[model samples]
Target: MTDEAALNALREAARLSPENLPLRRHLADQLLASGNLSQAETEYQAALGLSPGDHGIAIGLAEALVRQGKNEAALTALDPLLAMPEHPVRAGVLAAQAMLPVNRMAAAHWYRYSVARDPSQADPELAHRLGIGQPSAPPPSSTSPSPIPSGPAGLPAQPPSPAPAAPTQQPSPAPAQQPSLIPTAHSPSVVPAPHAQPQAAGGPYGSADVEPTAEVEHSPVTFADVAGMDTVKEALRMKLLLPTQQPELFAAYGKRAGGGVLLYGPPGAGKTHLARAAAGELGAAFVNVGLADILDMWTGSSERNLRATFAMARRNRPCVLFFDEVDALAARRSDMRQAHSRQIVNQFLAELDGVDEHANEGVLVLAATNAPWYIDAAFRRPGRFDQMVFVPPPDTVARAAMLSLMCRDKPQAKMDFDKVARATEGFVGADLKGLVDRAVEAKLHESIRAGRPIPLATGDLMTAAKTMRPTAVREWLGTARNYVLHANESGAWDELLPWLRDLR
Candidate 1:
């Protein structure tokens, strides 16, 4: 039969037997081949519903979405498959293709990740566009296995028919022709292939590399979402928020909106939340970077990653690049034995100082660290992380507010939050969440025994609070007290004094 006739036959078969997963997939594949993208997408969705977690069905669906320019939707479809322990090759390649237009660096990583695991999955042309594969090299000869088709505008084309099997099924042994995503004994690494492509100019990785770490997000979580820390809010508004809002006003006083603000406090004091809120309050793009995003076992990769991250922020002007556990990436070089570790810190400093081709004109860098004492001192200079804000445990009023907020969505009685807050003195935001969880869990048990639903009363929460310890807050306060006493020469820890006094 002709191709079109074959497709029609499959379509009729699928319509007659909707529950036949393989038939549905085959029809979707034929529909995809015939350029009926919408029909292909629908058929693929039907196949996925019949057999969810079927990798082939998911990839076909994602490919159809991408072909229709719904890159985000394609990614959403592929995310579960990507999250598997052994990343599916087609899923990874399709994800990389979807991400390329918006985020080339991330695309490169995903492409490398897939091709490393299964070399036959490599799409040399797509890799070349992403600046990770060899562009100058010739295409595969007629004698070799046909190259995976790069669909219209490089949307991931369908791969050679893959058995609709579990992702754990290993591929035939193929040459290890691509870069390795395998990490070293020390930390995760992205070891480049012998013919690894070069990063574009305009600084390391360039403006083209829009997303180096996590995707840049437009945060809607304003300071209002934050439970308390009114003082921290105010400080952030003045130091970070106001300048962005009234740039011309700040400029009159020889001040600029973009600079670094370091937030240090006990764990679960909402430091990360506050940074996100600051970005939201300004209505800017927020990029949250962590240690895993920056560190690589290979030499110079960490610095390159850091530089790429800054390049990404610079591209997204009025961006808030918030780094959590900043101390890990910016640890005291004096204490570091490894040269690579020190190089990472130096790269961090250069990026903060805008010492490279890319300037941080409108990018406000905010970082949070529980152990502020461990960060390199050079980061404290006037232009770097100059504004060190100390976030303290929430006061009684704040605790009450947090309790009410936590209970807002839970099934609970009209309980007095203030009494509970007063009783739980040293509990931080995390502790309060734990308290609510405990109360809900206990209520669940009670409901099970009574054979009915039970709403949590104030007494239930009080009992839960009593069972938990505020050791984290106590330990953080103790550490702050020591730093204030002996290391207050520069008075960086002076703002922490009141909290220390309260702790005593």
Candidate 2:
């Protein structure tokens, strides 16, 4: 493709996904390479907004300013990055080079400093112009009569050329270096281009090709997309949704922005769907994790993976980290027969507690489990899994809603939703969907038989519901009942108690 075409394509992509830091940075790099200094500066500034602490992008912006002959502006742009310890040699080199056109003396100081940090990258050609040689020990005191070597002509050999017209303002040296703990900044709204999830030998989730970056997976589902379960919806609105929308009100009473909300119920009860809806409603990024994302076959790796996942989650602040079947990972330590399993539980607690260096500061952790009884009791402490919301089978209202939604596009007559909903009591969202499919199948067969069309009616749906066997809720409730009775401490199972009593 032509350069113009590539530039246009990148610009369009950056426009479409304005929060995409990597895409914007890549576009900025391309523009700078093409000598489009002004546009490159704008793109770099944008990328910097998305990732304020990114030194590489900061240096890139400085370079663009330097290319435009704004040496003083370049120095200001490079200030924050230069202040960072393990001082980036690239930033220093760029700072030195950006100053070369006007402030040769200041440029010489930075040049010497850059070469001290990275001998390989210092531009030899530029160093030659400043009357400097390769990096060596400290030079003699400035009081010496002859600071630099003189040629046979009694003058410095190859006298440095004068810089172009200097701007009114003088350039200052790079800022003093300070320590920075900036991690890789990846915008949670941006889905990285498809690539392998490379792993390393010693590090947790690492490889030469991969840097420790944030993980953000998007979900299109919102509360409107969720089929039914108004009870569950209102519970979420009160627990997760309201606080996020009005954080200041909650903070007035010492409440933090995000916390853990446990969604537990029978299998296929739309627990995962509820989590996705919460993410969508918040307009926050979503990351759905499973055993495959954390568990490793090797020893001591599981805990590291847990730490790494939490770290990644925190980086994608305001992120919803949904864990399906979380009981398998956070199972009661007393019940765990193996030491490794127990250790993993401890690691989870540490992450939840914001131990040592890591914390779930802005991350909203949502874990769903069929066996909430299996999760370690420690996980239910104040800050972690504080609110447990039971996602029961679809009620009459939910059943009717699910049926109407499923059949909205199909040829359905004025249907008696109440009749079908009453018939399919104890059914979950998945089961309700199956009933609709069965009804559609019947309509399809009748159409084929008569060689004409037949719209779905209430009789068609009720017949399909009757044909279906006992709902899966029966199987799940049988197991859950035993827990609510035997382990009723802390009233964690109090909500389940009422439901169990109703079933009886």
Candidate 3:
């Protein structure tokens, strides 16, 4: 087949398997080669989203952007990769090319620095434009001085070219003979990528091929920042926070600080926010892994992503690794028709168990799902999501607190939050926010008609809440009741019984 036909076939395949990162990247590479800059950019972005922080893919994306005369965009793409401690050589070259139009000196610095590292990529036009070397001059030999400056501050003074040696007789000086420039004003200092960490040798989840897309951050939100759920907060303090705070005391009783806690509730009920608060309370690194971060269309890649995610959390000790919508990743294997899907579930179980050399001594695993009943039974086993924490919808007091906070910034009259909270019974945090938004929107419309700004009041919120029902609560409670009634063998979900009874 012709090259065009092969490219078309690959394009169709990529379209069919949109989540296939390698295939998307290969197609992007082909598109770049074929000079389809726009299409290539799109595919590269998709692939980058799948396997974030891949240097090769980032460089390819920047190159494609630069070729399309989107120099600003290309520089944006390269900035993060260039900041990484270990980046590909091409990243520097592409960055130099992108920077040339805006800043010649910076471009020259990057070009010379890159070429100094590996001379084969030397470009005459770029070198000449940056005033580094003559366009007509022969490529530098190993013995020649590097065009890069001696230090970070200024350009190097060129010495006269050395006399040519015979084709194969001269001894070459090592590249290290030249002084390595410190990070310049344009190039930032060497820093490890957010997901980059040292891997343990031959460990099950220690492969460097996959870098977790989930960011490890020190959450600043404590229980004080969280609005309510006093019962849930107390439970978390005992189950997670207190143990970490008094590790020695807990250890004496044969209890370790780290374990898994599953937070299941209706969507937008502040499950994620609570997890972050737990991390903040412990002063731990929070790694929030979403469904998109783990699922991959390619075989084995999903498992690798999952392993790498757990590996990352392990490396960052005292980490609260919270997986949101985890039901998709750890669903019942018996119900899955695809072997790959079951493999992902199995991989998740193994990671939780910390199989082989991997240990979860200091890692606190937390997962949130709206449909916890869908997760595998094995996940509920001891040491792996053994604690089922039910996050119920906001109570009246919690709703009042939330309403007061949500309205703090808005122009308002003397608002009775309790009145509004009482009217919107069973509303979750997100539903309350939406009610506030609708009220503000109505106020805006009324203000326009009256030609004056109108302030929000208790009545405005109550009026808005009248039209909106507790949409997610009913559906979620319906499902939870069935599980609690029939599948509560281990009684992990016994706490949900009260909420389920309220549904009656």
State each model's C-alpha RMSD to the native: 22.2, 22.9, 14.2
Which is the leading candidate under TM-score?
Answer: 1
Ranking by lDDT: 3, 1, 2
Give me the runs in candidate 2 sitting further than 4 Å from their true place.
Answer: 1-215, 355-358, 449-453, 502-504
- What does candidate 3's lDDT look like per residue over 353-430, in tens digits? 887533997788888999988888899898899888888899899999989988989999999999999998989999
lDDT of 3: 0.75
Summing lDDT over every window of 10 consecutive residues in candidate 2, give the lowest-scoring window. 180-189
Q: lDDT tens string, model 1, 1-504?
A: 998888888888888898998899889998998899999999999999998978888899999998998887787687556544355788888877887887665567668657655677888889888877622222222222222433233222323333233475533221212222222222222322232223333212233332365579999889888887887788777765787778789989977668888998899988888888888988989999876677653335567778888888888888999999888888887886444566678889988988643388788899999999999899999988988888888999999999998898878878999999999998888999999999999999999999998888999998998898885998888887888999889878888777776665
Model 2 agreement with the true structure over 229-321: per-residue lDDT tens digits: 777777667655677788889779876566788899998788998899888877878888877666543224456667778777777777888
Instruction: Assess candidate 2 and give its lDDT.
Output: 0.71
The C-alpha lDDT values of all candidates are 0.75, 0.71, 0.75
**Alpha-carbon TM-score of each model against the true structure:** 0.59, 0.57, 0.57
Off by over 4 Å in 3: 1-208, 355-358, 446-454, 502-504
Number of clashing residue pairs, candidate 1: 0
lDDT, model 3, position 34: 93
